[model samples]
Target chain A: MRAYGFRVPGGFHATHTYEAVEAAERIGYPVVMKIVSPDVVHKSDLGGVRLNISTAQGVRDAFDLMMLRINQRLPDARIEGIYVEKMVSKGLEIIIGMSRDPQFGPMLMFGLGGVFVEVMKDVTFYIAPITHDEAMQMLMSTRSYKMLVGARGQQGVDLKAIATGLQRISQLSTDFPQIAELDINPFIVGEFGTDPVAADVRMALQSPED
Target chain B: MLEPLLYPKTIAVVGASKKPGKVGHEILANLIKGGFTGKIIPVNPTADQVLDLPCYKSPVDCGESIDLSLIVVPNRAVVEAVKSSIKAGAGAIVVITAGFKEIGEEGAALEREVAEICVSHGVRLLGPNCLGLINTENRMNASFGGDIPMAGGVSVISQSGALCTAILDTAAGLNLGLAKLFSIGNKADVSEVDLLRVLGRDEQTKVIVGYLEDITSGDDFIKAATEASTIKPVIILKSGTTVAGLKAASSHTGVLAGADTAYGAAFMRSGVIRAENYEDLFDFATAFAIQPLPKGDRVLIITNAGGPGTMAADAVENAGMRVMSLDRNVATALKSKLPAAASVGNPIDVLGDADPDRYLAALEAAQEDDSVDAVIVILTPQAMTRPVETARAIVVGCQKGDKTVLASFMGGRGVLPGRDALAAAGLPQYYSPERAVAALKAMHDYAAWKRRPPRIVARFRVNTRRVERIITRCLRANRRQLG
Candidate 1:
């Protein structure tokens, strides 16, 4: 999560369409608008996301539509605010997470992200906190490592950047023991020379118990 | 300590019975038959004597300290029996009754009571449903199981008494020796961690083989095993070692990060050989029992058949061992000595019809190859092949060694005699080339582990507070991320 020094899309939210347009202009064009709330876990599934808005008018209009649709979809749903962020167009999606296993202590997981992740789940696990070399091994051991390394004419991503991101997550969990379940989905790993960024992150805190 | 638990000076069979088929009677009989010179006392309320040993109404009435007590009373009477054993100042107790834990909530509560009693009394309890423990040093057959096991360096600690007996029978057949065998059922007080740490210090134990179903918490055990592997090999065969990489879940690493993944990491970090299956467990133990660790990673596969040799080559490579190319001189010598049909490659097949003498010539070539760290000799049942003679020749060639050698006598009826020869020579042998390669791989892995430097974990403090503040700002601004 951005709160944990993990890279995330940059943009700002505003109260009105005018403020939304102004915020989009300040952040640059091609922003994504989504309904942000404490209640909603899956915003896209609720038709609460508007993507790739290139113009200020596009950001303003999309923000209004997103809020209206979310309100109409769930009449009882409490609206927290609207989230606007710069859209990431070029990158392969990957997922990284950590879950504290009662028996095994802290465990970290890595795998390919996107829709096909469920159809063809390719993932691996390691006990936290993993070193840079081990993080690299976890990345390379996955089925998508070849794609990350640029196979079949597809462009390669900066593996070190992603490995470093994983290591940072490792450090984050180590630093914050209260985190029980963490999911950083669709960590957009850009083509060579570009830093990989975590697009979405959700963490569930561990409830205190014996 | 383990002295009273393992080499007890006086043992009491709490539920001693006159009946032949009863567990108490059988344990009493096994002790006498095992030639245990230590005093064996029987405890029973009604019986005058059991197995000709004078009986006491209870351990409390024994009027002397009991080093170890084997409690085989009924489920209802176990707690009372254990308390009396504790009252008699028993240092260790092996409860042989089974109603505890395995029978569910009430039984688990009962087991907990037993554990609490043992801890409060400062006593070590082996099991509530165990076959019992054996001390090869004292020739003590404390279990109701069969004949006294042979005394040797390997120590077996198993959670399952049935599996322990099976392994004992197998070890007996293979002429393997054991320093101790513990059927640590339900581990009420002493778990694998306690035994591993204790046995790591026991001089009689050179290798430890553990069969466990679960490992709940083992940071101390990992540290102990890591220290133990510094001097001896610890081979473990864990039941239900699930591959975390196969579990389907919402997270990408769900499968790879399952519960069992921790065990794998623990073993790797501690430098223990975790056998993939039962056969691997046996093979690895047998290799460690018979052979020395390989000097290096280079392995040479010499066989009579090309196919099996290549299969072994692939296996060796898969096991992360290299089949190094022989030196020019060694290859030339092999080329000239081997028949025209032979190949002088890494496998260095000596032709199918090659006899024991041909095997010797190749074995000699392997020994001469400076790059060859270990040799796996494969023999097929060819018409002209003399399997036993080849085995003897291979053993002879391996005798002049700094390098270790293993034999693979492939086939059933025809290779049995040769396999026996290899076994009789105290040389490790397998029925298949891959099995042989696996044994060699174990040797290589042990060597590699021994060579690994002391582990040091470098921790980096990444400042998440700055990231947290930025994220909080974004959340208030309704922005979650940016490219």
Candidate 2:
């Protein structure tokens, strides 16, 4: 099953191994290491995530600690190592999700991201394969969107780009039954005019047929 | 129209058994124990005697024509039992069996088959997967399920079996009686709409209450409720109003609709009263069942405490009813009755130290004013404020006046005497200002709706037709595939 994300202009993927850590050190500083285990969808829950690694030893130490933590917490999960991506700076956080309801068919949910998803519970749902109209409605329903629209002198996040991204996620969930859940948290909205980038992504796929 | 089914003169347990713990035997025991005035027949194949009544082999074998049949048997045998009951000319059948639509596709097909059987035979089926109905007024225990209900004015119809029992138990604790109770689980033939339509016309049914997960026939529910609201009040406690709540409801009942905003609009247009919580629903129903509708939306606030009066004012305003400002004459009259230090406003805070006679005097003055449509008297505990005597005085003053009187006693333990005294006098009383204000608002709204014509204009004209066509085609396709 293919997992296609919205196109980020300068985005590139880097596979993390013992050698990749050394390469990352040679290339740059301030990288994020995320556990790439398909079984562990929420890597941060098991402490398999390390952010803002600035040095060679920082990379090596974080890798060791993350590996040990993942093995200790989820002993049965297969370790596919990790993905080291450039540490993107702060932005307006949001979450988009989809699930097939038995009665209402496919449903798309969009809301404020991070811990605020539970705390604020500012979310809206629509039957999936959502039109652009519905996507815009979901964004407008949430109070966090106030900040996205430049509340309190903050630069307004690009709403058109966010709406397009949401539409892609909805289509993806409708297209693949195997894709149970997917999340891209803190997809940093770079500047006033710059497009948002998916900084950290975690996905869960259905087990292969017996 | 079907009085015998509701208040049966003769009820026959088709699958009755001599075994002590069986459903049929338990139902018979409960019916006999509840002192049902109707004649009971036990139909068993082998046993000559069960529950001290002659047990026949079948409904045909039992000589008398039965009004209702309580069918408690396995899934395969239900069809045969229903067929026999139909041949014996039974009017209604309450099927207390599971393994139907609620399970999955195949079970849904079986449920349709049972419904078809009922339709073809002209026998109204209460449920294929239900606890069945109870007419407490007539001591008619038709349900095979456990709860022996008490007689009261509130009639509740629940979509869930467990919730029905829970509401019954809670109502029992609250000293509320149910006029009739129905657990319409998996409503194959008889639906909530059907029951609502029937009970709406029932004379003994003062308050028609419901606990619903979904409205299967949205148009039918709107139509039935619109007509029902013309005569009686319909209070509903619907669960699936939020996305998370919709998820829980689906897992509980497997039915989901669009957003709750649409449902709210539909409910408003149909003139149905929606309650926020379980306690609110029961409290509103109790008040509606007992109290007369308010003459107008103008409300007079009477309180011994200032904070509760403010709270009552807020609640009253929130419910879209006005808190009446005291007339100059009424204020002058109240000033003469109250002490000089007392605040003689609309809420008429007569001071906590005021006696029962002072409360009576204030209420009398407020009630005499033509501008005051209703009066809500609030009492708080104080050293000199005789709670019981003050309640009696207010009740007496209410009896003498033309205005509707409502009371709020705002404390935990100190409010019992006031509540009991009001209840004994058949006057509406609430524990909190919010509840008292809500009840008064509902009374006001009901009176207003009664004056106006029913306002449902049939949205979903094309969508409903399309859905009906789709359902018809699907049913026909499924029948062909099965055959």
Candidate 3:
């Protein structure tokens, strides 16, 4: 995703406590650690995620504690390692994704992260390989567009950042047909010209026969 | 390639029959009654002759350069009939036979086999389960569905044969003319995409209408529909949504991408006007077929009754269009020409007792106003109202300008003459003000789509090599899904 120009946080996989501490130091203090496993989804729910670990000792302890809890909860799961990364600042939560339509090929989707998508289903879609104008139109089509523009005198986030993220996802989905479905939940975005972070990513691949 | 299918000079009915009410018999009779100039050979194995024409045992025995062969044989013999038609030098085929794909796996396999044979022979097939097709330009009614439609610019394609009949009946009742009609059942080879391109280039077709349950391919459909919509209006009434593709969804994105969402997106991007129901299909078609495309979204309502005028105003507002207030000079001109009781606002109420001349005066003023792009004239049955004369005045008022004018003569028995007069002048008349406004909204939206600048999709610089490597590694590890 970073290769496609999306602003992903600095991160690396670490298999041991020493490696986790060193990676956290390399990324600088005030970092986050998440369990790296293909079998385990919802890392936060599984207690496999720790945030705001400002010290090297804190990174070491968080890594050991996350591994122990994950191991106890999901004994059959295969743990790839732990992911140490820089913690991004707070911003408006938005979701950008791509799901290959059985008929239309790649389709890009946009909506606010929480209730707008989960409960209201207030989302809009456009076929992949969309233009900048189309990406902007997709955002404006959603019922929650005013939220991104700052409703009720609140500070609005950078709309171009979200649109660019959608365009990049479109390009990625078009480039890699095997990447069938992808979701960048909580794509934290700030005001205009400010880079947004793809804080978490979930992706799936097309089965061989399909 | 589809010229032969749509404009065949010679046709052969492979399952021609002798009994009344039979599919084959009705098709042959309709062809003859439709006054087709081309030779129509009836091929029946059992009968020596049918409908007083020399019937051959098969299309193969006919020994003619058959441009199109209409097959209505039983399901088991459909493949054989198609094979024989191909052997007889059939350029195209239309299999009206049912029981393919819609029945079961066995039927689907049989349909595929028939399609394969056509493909191997380089022949285009219309249907293995359809209502056949009709070309009014060639004066041919090659389907067993119904009578020949009146010839005009609106062409229709339907996925449902039953809906095709309903559309035909409605068109006939409404006196709407059709250029061509195809019931693309089971779209084994010639799908809606193929027909869209064909109709898009057809000289006689000004409006393309469709009744689709589902599209063959979404990407191809968007491409074809986009192109066709550029040439002329394409109105589609799509119904039904199946969750067949959502069962394997593993992500929230996949789950949110419902069965119908993609279709909606595709339609919007393609500039195709989606009609919400059967009525909308023809209403929009007729509006596009006859009325000029509005240059702007500003509309002026001219009505005899204030209530219907307000209804029209509400409908226009709800559709995101403007019931624009006339300018000061235009309002002054209208007030001078109209009665003192008439309100000169957006809904220019000419009063309940208004006659043809008052309606004409308001219409003329609206047409001359630069802010008004369209005008909806509504009339109700009153003691002094003249339905027929008011309709004629509307026709004459709109005859000089490019401004679009529609009507809503809101009564069943009393407004028939007015509606008939509007129909005669090729003016679209709805039964209610809201319906008229809805049709106007469709026209405005289509005009907006056409006015948009050409789409230029941006291609970003990306590391494709790395993507390929990652996908290859994942698949090599037998992990079909990656997190």
Candidate 4:
């Protein structure tokens, strides 16, 4: 996504505790740390994620603790390395995703992330690649659109930036037929001019035999 | 590709029979009675004559080249019939035979074999287990679905033959005219996409209606439907919307991306008006065919009673349309013409006892108001209410304006004459306020869709080579699931 000009947080991979400290100092804290393994699909579920590590010593401790938790939980999970990244501030949480529909090639999905999406199922979809206007319409079609427009006197997030992000993802999905399903959950969006960051991403590819 | 199927110059009933109750005999009889101007040749080995037309032993023996062949033979002999028809220079084929594809694997294979022959010869095929088609433009009633429909602007396409008959019945009852109708059974060769493209280009059709059990290809449907919808309103009623074709995945989007949702998104993107039920399909078709598109969503209601006026207001709001307060000038104009007991707000209630003149006054004022995009005239039969006269008044006031009008004559026997009058004047009248409101909303949405900005998909400078390399490397390593 970053290759397609999407805003993503800076991060580095470190295999050892000393390397983790060095990478954190270079990237600057407060930062987030997580276990990087092909086996551990959901890092936070396995207690493999740590946040608000503001210093080099904090990064060292968080990395060791996350690894220890993952090893104890899975027992046989492969631990590739530790991922350290800059932490974005509190912002509105939105999810942007793509699922390659067998009939229609690629469908882009949008919703307010977390409980709103899980409980209410307030989501909308559009076939990609969509125009920027279509992306905006997709966002407004949801029941949670008022929340994005700043409900109860709260500040509204940068909606144009979100539309642009959606366009980029739509292009990405159209460009790569190998990508079967993708999700950028909690794409943290801040007020007005602030750029939204893709906090976490997951993508799946079509089976080789297919 | 479908020219011969829709406008055949010469048609051959391949299984034409002497027996009246037989499928072949009814189809041949329908062709003669429906007033098809072209030559109708019946092909049957056992009969020399059918319904006064000379019968040929086979299509190969028909002497003249056949533009279309309607086959209604037994299941086992369908393939041979199609082959002989194609051999006799038939441009298109409509197999009215049953027990193919809808039966089982053996039937499906036979259907495929027949389709393969049609494809190899470049001849279009309509169905192997379906009802035939109708074209009112040429006075051709090729189907055995009974009488030839009155020629009008609305055309229909349905997957189920029974639904086609029901639509035909409803259309006749409602006095809605039709241009062309097709029953695409099994869709072995020609599907909705092909018909959409053809009908979208057809000048005689103003509105296209469809009933589909399933679409053959989603991408092709979007392309064809989008093109058709841009030309005119394409209303469809699609059933079988269960959560089929879902894949187990790790994301919320993947879990929620079912067949129904994808179809919904596709329809939205392509600008197709989706009808919720059988009634909605005709209601929408009636509105689109008879009335001009509303320029905006603001609706003005004119009624003879308070309850129906209020009902119209509530229905308008519920349909996402605005029952806006009347413009000040229009309100002032209505006040002077109406009785003192009448209210001249959004629902300009011209009292329960008011007659045709009061409706004429309110409708005239609404016609000149630029802010009101549509008008709904509701009438309830009262002791002194003139249903027929008031309906005529509405026709006179609304006939010349850009603003479209829909009427809701809210009673059965009392409003029959008035509803017929409105129908004759090419104005859509509904049974109730809710139905009228639904139709008006459909027009509003289609107008808005037409007024939307041109679609421009942004194409960025993408790294195609890198994406190709990554995909190739993953597939080569047998790593289908990647992060």
lDDT of 2 by residue, A1-210 (tens): 113445332322334556647656655777877776646745677897788888878878887888889888889987766667677666787766554443333456677676557566666665555566556766886777787788777878878767766777766656554443455555566446676776654443332130
Residue-level lDDT tens digits of model 3 in A42-150 = 6888998898899988988898899999999999899999999899867898899888888888889999998889999999989888988889999988889889899
Q: Return the top candidate by DockQ.
A: 3
**Candidate 2 docking: what grade?**
incorrect
Tell me the tens digit of each residue's lDDT in model 4 across B1-483: 688888889999999989988889888888888899898999999987888888898998978899999999998998899999998889999999999899999999999999999999999999978889999888888888989988999888899998988999999888899999999999999899999999999999999999998889988999999999999999999888633355676777887777588888888888899898988998899999988899898999988888888988999998889997678977887798888989888788888898899888888888888989899999999999888888899899886687888989989898899898888777888999999999998888888888899999988776777777877887777655544
Q: Which runs of model 3 end up more than 4 angstroms from their true locations?
A: A12-32, A50-69, A207-209, B60-63, B242-245, B479-483
Error of 1 at B436 (Å): 2.9
Better of 2 and 4 by DockQ: 4
TM-scores of all predicted structures = 0.90, 0.63, 0.93, 0.95
- Preferred candidate (TM-score higher): 1 or 4: 4
A best-first ranking of the candidates according to their DockQ comes to: 3, 4, 1, 2
For model 1, the stretches where C-alpha displacement exceeds 4 angstroms are A1-4, A15-17, A48-51, A57-75, A89-92, A112-120, A149-157, A190-194, B240-256, B442-450, B464-483
- Tens digit per residue, CA lDDT, model 1, B72-172: 99988999999999888899999998999999999999999999999988899999899998888899999987888988888999999999889899888
- List per-prediction Cα lDDT, in the order shown: 0.81, 0.72, 0.89, 0.88
Can you write out model 4's per-residue Cα lDDT over A24-140, one digit (the tens) per residue?
889888888878776776677789888788987888788778878887899898788988889887799999999888788888999999998889999999999899999999999
lDDT of 2 by residue, B1-483 (tens): 556568777787877867888777787777777778888888888889987888889988888788888887777788888888888778888888888988889888888888898888788887778877788877877765556666778899888877877787877655677898888888887888888898888877888999888877766777888788777999888886535234422110112223464355345546678887887787788778766778888888878888999999889888778888788877887788778988777677888787889889888887788888888889999877788888899888987777877788878777687677776665667788888888788778777757764322221112334423433463444321100
lDDT of model 1 at position A5: 56
Per-residue lDDT value at A127 in model 2: 51
What interface Cα RMSD is found for model 2?
14.9
Off by over 4 Å in 4: A17-29, A52-76, A207-209, B242-245, B462-473
